[model samples]
Target: MSEQPKTSAAPARLPGGNRRPAGGPPWANAGMPAEKSMTFWPSARRLIHRLRPYRMALLSVVALGVASVGLSVYVPKILGQATDIIFSGVIGRRLPTGSTQEQAVDGLRAAGNDNLADMLARMDVTPGAGVDFTALSTILAWAVVLFVLSSVLMWAQGWILAGVVQRSMYELRAEVEAKLHRLPLPYFDNQPRGELLSRVTNDIDNVAQTLQQTLSQLLTSLLTVIGVIVMMFWISPLLALIALIAVPLSMIVTQQIAKRSQKQFIAQWTHTGTLNAHIEEAFTGHELVKVFGRQKEVEATFAARNAALYDASFGAQFVSGIIMPSMFFIGNLSYVAVAVVGGLRITSGAMSLGDVQAFIQYSRQFTQPLTQVASMANLLQSGVASAERVFELLDAAEQSPEPAAREAAPTRGRVAFEGVDFRYQADTPLIEDLSLVAEPGQTVAIVGPTGAGKTTLVNLIMRFYELDGGRITLDGVDVTELRRDELRSKIGMVLQDAWLFGGTIRENIRYGRPDATEEEIRAAATATYVDRFVHSLPDGYDTVIDSEGGNVSAGEKQLITIARAFLADPALLILDEATSSVDTRTEVLVQQAMAALRTGRTSFVIAHRLSTIRDADLILVMEDGRIVEQGSHSQLLAAGGAYRRLYDAQFTSAAVDLDESGAAAVMAR
Candidate 1:
């Protein structure tokens, strides 16, 4: 008697106010943002801590990154020197009297570049003199080599960082998967499966993409900015001051735009999940939509969600889109400022023409990183948003801890509920002060109308939902005192909608008891009569079942499920409307197999058809969450109570719904 719902209605609204088709339960925040508020930095810190193990690899990546940026920055200076060599060649003049090599060495010393002066003196060129093409070509060659080395370092850094980011994502995904298993059922009840799937797949993927695309770029950009700033000052302090003015302005502009666009990015991420949730819901329930003729309404819902997604996406993209161009505009402005100022300095002989060119190049290099950061601003924000969602799932409270001193207890088929109280919601009580006991090997039949707490009782027995008060015990020991796995191992459940994963029929059955031998599997299948149809299929037990077991008939699926439960050979069995889907002939076979399986076990049978449980040792009839009648069939019928009325109603309804000829025969009888 598993309490898991066979079908649940779609939530009214997904996150971001994307509504499902109208007319359903209250809107759920399933795939939406967390109700429990969280800040950004805390989630970021958690992810950073997860990435701590690979810090050395990251450090190596940083070293490579810095080396790459340094080479890149140094190349422009070398190119500027090459430009100076070419300019001197075009001028082509001999030194005037008294302008000796000693004076050139003194000038270089004042410029703080004695090494360049030494190299120049070694070249033995008299100033002003004819072109030194050989020396000039050598400087240009060195520039090319430096450029090649810089590119190689950049490539190496990218490669190493890719591995680090991917490995961190792997560990992150594993932790989230493990956390899913540890989270309580109640947590899932309030969450959308689509949203959780998004966290594990899409959201984490966003984080990975951000790391791969942005992390190295961020490091390079920061280093480039600092390196370029230093080079600009070294070229000429006055021109560097002129270029530095834009730094504050660029930061101000970037901060303003990023602050606005970050909100849009958050909305973009939320709406993206909402849209995914809607698509998942619509597809999962597509058959229901067609049956109920809700295609138009479903489309309408989709259109609305798509529109919401588009708005968020457009806003985020448009706002972030401007950041690059805006930063470029500021960069170009600073370039103009440097050109006007450096040109005057070069004319005044306060700076060389080559120095002015390098200063202009340095100004561009400095702003390039700012431009990159602005472009990546939206990506980083989106990643941060996704990280928050993933962290929320990881931070969710896990199932209650087991007692430290507890040991495994023998489950000998005896079960009892002592004054149990439970409710799905705080305001709505489904079961109140319910008490019952099933002795070893007893068959307890619980019959009730839908929502009469019949399934809830089964849920309580399985400890799917914590009881608000009182306690449930197995073999005289409180079930909660035992480990959940240990307790559930003793109970086998078969529901109305038989659940089968995507695997071979034999594999699905083996899933019940992973250690079961082939012989044991065959024996269990034989007992459940599943072997009858199984052998007929071309692949026999090797036949693969689709997700939801759709490849097989419902009755056949149930039989296989029964075979699974039989293989487990649990001491307590729960048959939840097990025969409700089968034809009369198949029902007889299933009932026979169920009887055989329950021979030595305590069984709780929740059935819509009363005739199946006529021979049960005890029958408890419930209404309004309380047992109104308790006795065997004959005893309950003799009492002429609510159970009798229910029995008569079902009997009369079956008679009335018979075919015309059968009705006449019944009337005649």
Candidate 2:
């Protein structure tokens, strides 16, 4: 048969099947910065690269937040102006910035100083400035308007901030998940499930949640601090100088907290995963715990893990919690000092009343952002830690993008392995330089003790694992050159475990062939003898299976799986005989179904009972990953080799009873 190269690609689908979901993208390389922990701070370029895609929206939000903060900074000035307008108009003199009306009135000796009374009259505003209230009223109205404006815009700014951060994190989560699907299978096998879950769910959530709180606050605070400092100098350079001294101290505190907390946060997340794993395991094995009477032991283990988690939590959060109150306390003290000293300057005639009032207000505006920065410090560290874990997983090596080619012309189902050697890792070959062939429509049986690489051979033929040394071909085409789905479509497997997903029976059967009709499903079920038992159930084909289908009998599950395989109509079938956990009654039904299904197909049967496979066209005996004997059962028996030894052991065990009629019929086939 000739092979035709088809170039059509599999359409990628997203997780949960809700959206046209692309799971995730590659965020970083897999093996860079091999540190003790997954937590890492991205470099400036990496951070910029992540932000580059959302630069436009981010810029707009930041600009709006700055405008909002800027609007708020001018609020106190109008209040000071109101105090001035009230005192001057009522007393007919400039109000003392502290007690202006009182101070100016005290300056006169009352007898010769009628000018002082005139000053006091000017300061009075009992009926209010009705006609001349234009400037003062306008200033007062503008102040109220600005306050309202800032509140509304700040709400809008927060909405935009949350939207940007959440959408960005969603994008990142998608990329990371995609990377997981494409990653080498060994990576998953090596990593813990809870840790992986933490990366996808918890870690990604942390980054997004923190970004909402921290990034916006950091930007607003930086702008606020800058604007406040500028205004402070404009108000009183000497007071601004005093505030600047406190700024450095704030920086010193923030830097120290950040450096210490970042490490603690990474450790905290890791411990969270460990603690989660512990609880999940304990709960899942509740029966085992009760049987073992190890409740105290489990409680102790949980306590130990919980204690570790708490230590990390306290260390990470305690440091972060300290930042806000410390900044605020120190900030308020500095503000008061600036107010007292600035007031003295104005009293001594070195500074104006307006200037001192503005300086105190400016002191507040400047320190506000600083206080925000200290508050947001923990979230910033947490976001960094979570981002690092996500990026690490996304950077793993993906499977080959191009798939192997399947022969277009229908196949004879002949499989040939030539000089095959394979190992999951670099060292310790599972199979060393093995060679074999299964002819079209022939039933080949492979038998071995555990760890003999019997299943490894099946995996290689299915292309689940790549051959280390040589090649495998179905018909005349190398399997490596076939499209993965196209190749898999031609082969059907009933694994030893008989995995049936949680769904209706029809759905599980249709998983192998989505286009399979209901009529076809029933016919396949009948062929496998599954129809007999299925129809007896209340729901028939529509019967629901729970997780692993625990309600159903194991043999019934295996029969349904076989029905599915039969429905798939693959040219080659792999049946691991332990699917029903083989016993006397189940063995007969499974064998009968398999006999009907294997009539015209090439089959690989992994049999636990040597008696079940005596009639195989070819029998391969394996031990320690190498074929020790190969031939038909009679031929092997006559030779009295490893096959003879195995047969003799079975005969001695008295556990196996071969049906002479069934054995003869299978051999004749």
Candidate 3:
């Protein structure tokens, strides 16, 4: 059956009419609200919860990070020891031969240079010795070993974190996939397809990247900052204090910039979803757009959405980009302060030259991590924004659950709608107190104008939407008591739109019943006349259908669907405008096949063509959700009511066209 017509004031609430409102882009629908301020912590916490299963791997990464950062922090101190050894040897070579180090210290003290004497006492030196290259070489060697070991541990940490992130993302993607299956039909009707696609593809990818890039680096940076601070204070407290002043300033900078950029990141992803929806719609309807001369309008809308996305992306990047430079400025100031203080301490002999040098290195190490942390703020914000979108999808309301104990479906199809009451919207009544029955082996044809709930009737029989009141039964058993899958397995349906997957023709036909033997497949194909055109092709049944099924004509596609339904051997069959796409000659053949298929099964056929249903056991004429007239075709035509008006209208138009053609031909002759 054709789709119900939509009104300009109200959205479509039934199948075929289940689309976002017209006259604007899908994102402009009232259902899709403006982008709100991101709830970063909640979304981030939920994202982190996805890693609960990887606790052991994450702990291993943490242990490696600690060892690596510890070794890295100590290496500079070891090198500082080597520096002291070299300096002490140079001084010792200038002293008198055989003079004790204690005697030199006393001599310096006697000259009233107490600070220099104290510095000399701190160093391990012999007054008469030359440079201690042996000790220096040992310290340098240890430093190299520590550096290499630290690097190995850091690499191992990164490797573990990468695995954990990927595995977590895999679980997340699986959950999203499963969640999509559970969402109700109405949810999809209100949502844009491309928006959902962006959430599944683009948003998940962004979240994965954020975790892969930031998790390891952020962990190591924070650990390095802690280790460096401890080493700095151990070497010289005064210089440590001088270096610590930059921490607050860096925090202030990060906090302020992140606040401004967080909203922009949210806007960026929201616009991305909207733009994706627009592109998907435009491409899917490209032929229609071109036929209507709306190519320029489509292009204009695309440009506007693209520009919005660009502006949002630019604003987010620009605001977050300020962080690194500001951090560098703060770090440089700390480095200078530490350097000047260390030099003065050395001149006063309050600190050893080696200790001062190690403290200076620690100061740089401290500031570098702070800078890195600041730089990563943008990635964290963007990722959290995307995570929030994914979370929303995962949290959408699901369809009603199945019963724990399911009733067995009936073997024979005897369907009845007893005092059924339903409506797409609470206020808009479509079907009220509707009652009907189709006995076993009977053919029931439903005829209706557009928006007359023809397709909605079949959809209800399939339990696509729940009734507002009353119940439907099959063979005197409530359909709700049976498992949906079990009930649906006994029925076969063919929709108006002939959907085919990208595969060989044989595979598409076998999709209806996977366990059907090859012989049975060919038999069903021949019965539906699909073999007529398929056999003419080079590959015959093996001919491949593209994603869009463009290689096959519409009639061929319809035939394949019919063959699929035929192969099911269903107890109940539903054909919704099944032959509307075929030409007159093909339609006649299809009608014969359908007649054979419906021989002993209860069938419900929804059709607009009145000529197709003249032989049906019963004809139901529906108008505005009510069965205004129903009986055998001859009886209804005899009464000259709704069914007679419809039948007359169709044949009258055909008769006029035929007479006009005849008159024109005679005049030309």
Give per-residue CA lDDT, model 1, range 23-99, as digits (tens): 22322564566544355556557666777888898888889888888988988888877777766554435444347
TM-score of each: 0.90, 0.83, 0.92
Residue pairs with clashing backbones, model 1: 1-574, 93-128, 93-129, 94-128, 95-127, 95-128
- Superpose all Cα atoms of candidate 2 onto the true structure and report the RMSD in Å to 1 decimal: 9.5
> Which candidate achieves the best lDDT against the true structure?
3
Q: How many Å off is the CA of 350 in candidate 3?
A: 2.0
True-vs-predicted CA distance for residue 348, candidate 2, Å: 2.9
Candidate 2 overall lDDT versus native: 0.74
Which stretches of model 3 miss by more than 4 angstroms? 4-27, 30-38, 94-118, 405-409, 654-669
lDDT of 2 by residue, 524-631 (tens): 888877787887888989999975777678788877788889899889999776444545776777677787888889999887578778778999998877899998
Output the worst ten-in-a-row residue range by lDDT, candidate 1.
2-11
Ranking by lDDT: 3, 1, 2
Report lDDT (Cα) of residue 26, candidate 3: 29
Task: Locate the minimum summed-lDDT window of 10 residues in model 2.
Answer: 1-10
Winner by TM-score: 3
> How many pairs of residues collide in each model?
6, 27, 0
Query: In angstroms, what RMSD does candidate 1 have relative to the true structure?
Result: 5.3
